[model samples]
Target: MRSLLSKVAVGLVFVFGGGLWAASAVADDVAHKVVIQVSTDDERTQKIALNNAVNIQKSLGVDEVKIEIVAYGPGLGLMTTAGKQSQRVADLVLQDITFSACNNTIKKITKKKGAAPKLVEGVGIVDSGAVRIIELQQQGYAYIRP
Candidate 1:
């Protein structure tokens, strides 16, 4: 049987080790690269997402941040020239953040709704946002949906 002092020492060691592990698990990154994914059809949600991305950059003090807003469905409106968020979207583009639309989604939208709006110059068209997300994950980028 161990003495009370030994048991207390072991408990403290366990607690401190667990705390260190937890801290290491979070990307409290001094300088790290991130690739966040954004896909939402709602305007309010899109605004919130944009805010979240900005907040993360500010909070983490990331050195190289590459946020990719992958728009699909009605979310494409957030990246279009005629869309209400054009000016605000431009703000992100200036920050080196990319805004891309799902080409597959555009095809479906055009086939079903008969109107295929084009994305702005700053906004690119990817084959599929889902595939992009998987590729990013495989590349070891932390996945955040805001």
Candidate 2:
């Protein structure tokens, strides 16, 4: 009887402890990361990208989703002070959505226009938007282009 009880105890420990560990693993996986690319100057496309980010955050719960939007080429305009979606960008920044503007594109525009474009208040500058997107993808972020 003593030996039987010891075996039962060991079996219970493996079953319950393993179950607890599995549950913890699932909870840890609740958070998801996504990166969005905006390469167009179109106002509609820019708004769609922002909408996609918001929708993902809402579907996943604010605390469970990490979102980044990388804008380059003509899309860099989306991160500029005079952008049509500038106010929306500011609001989303408060919600923890990251906005990345390409420095290379900025430089090109600056040289052509004779002045650097003014970025929105919360925009971050990345050396290259394409590279940023690749890095984010390597780090396991899902990518979306709208």
Candidate 3:
């Protein structure tokens, strides 16, 4: 009877422990995550990055991937409400692609222009664009610069 009870207890541990391990593995397995960095103010570069993001989503399926675009320096201009590409940015946001603007850049621009630039709706502000890219890379996100 003692041997039988021990065997049952061991089986229970294996069943529960295996279940926990499987759950943890599933949680850690992300399909794909990409962080695209844009530091130049060139409209061509900005448009290329945006096209790359759309292509990635189309190739991988929107639900199978995550994408973030971090803009700083002159690139932050792309996120401004008055930017020529603001409408395109807004459209991309609706598709689950995220856009981040550097707060440091905003401060510098504000100091020079005497006012903070208006950001399009849904644009996130981060303390630093480069740092944000680093953090995302550390979290296993793939990095791209166009």
Number of the top TM-score candidate? 3
Task: Please tell me which model should have the higher lDDT, number 1 or number 3.
Answer: 3
Query: Residue 88 deviation, candidate 1, in Å?
Result: 0.9
Candidate 2 lDDT? 0.94
**Residues 65-118 of candidate 3: C-alpha lDDT, one tens digit per residue:** 889999999999889999889999999999999999999999999999999999
lDDT of each: 0.74, 0.94, 0.94
Candidate 1 clashes: the total is: 0
TM-score head-to-head 2 vs 3, winner:
3
Across residues 1-146, which tens digit of lDDT does each residue of candidate 2 receive?
99999999999999999999999777556479899999999999999999999999999999898899999999999999899999999999999999999999999999999999999898999999999999999878999998
User: What TM-score would each prediction reach against the true structure?
Assistant: 0.69, 0.80, 0.84
Query: Which runs of model 3 end up more than 4 angstroms from their true locations?
Result: 1-30
Scored against the true structure, residue 107 in model 3 reaches a CA lDDT of 98
For candidate 3, the per-residue lDDT at 36 reads 97
- Alpha-carbon error at 136 in model 3, in Å? 0.2
Model 3 weakest 10-residue run by lDDT: 24-33
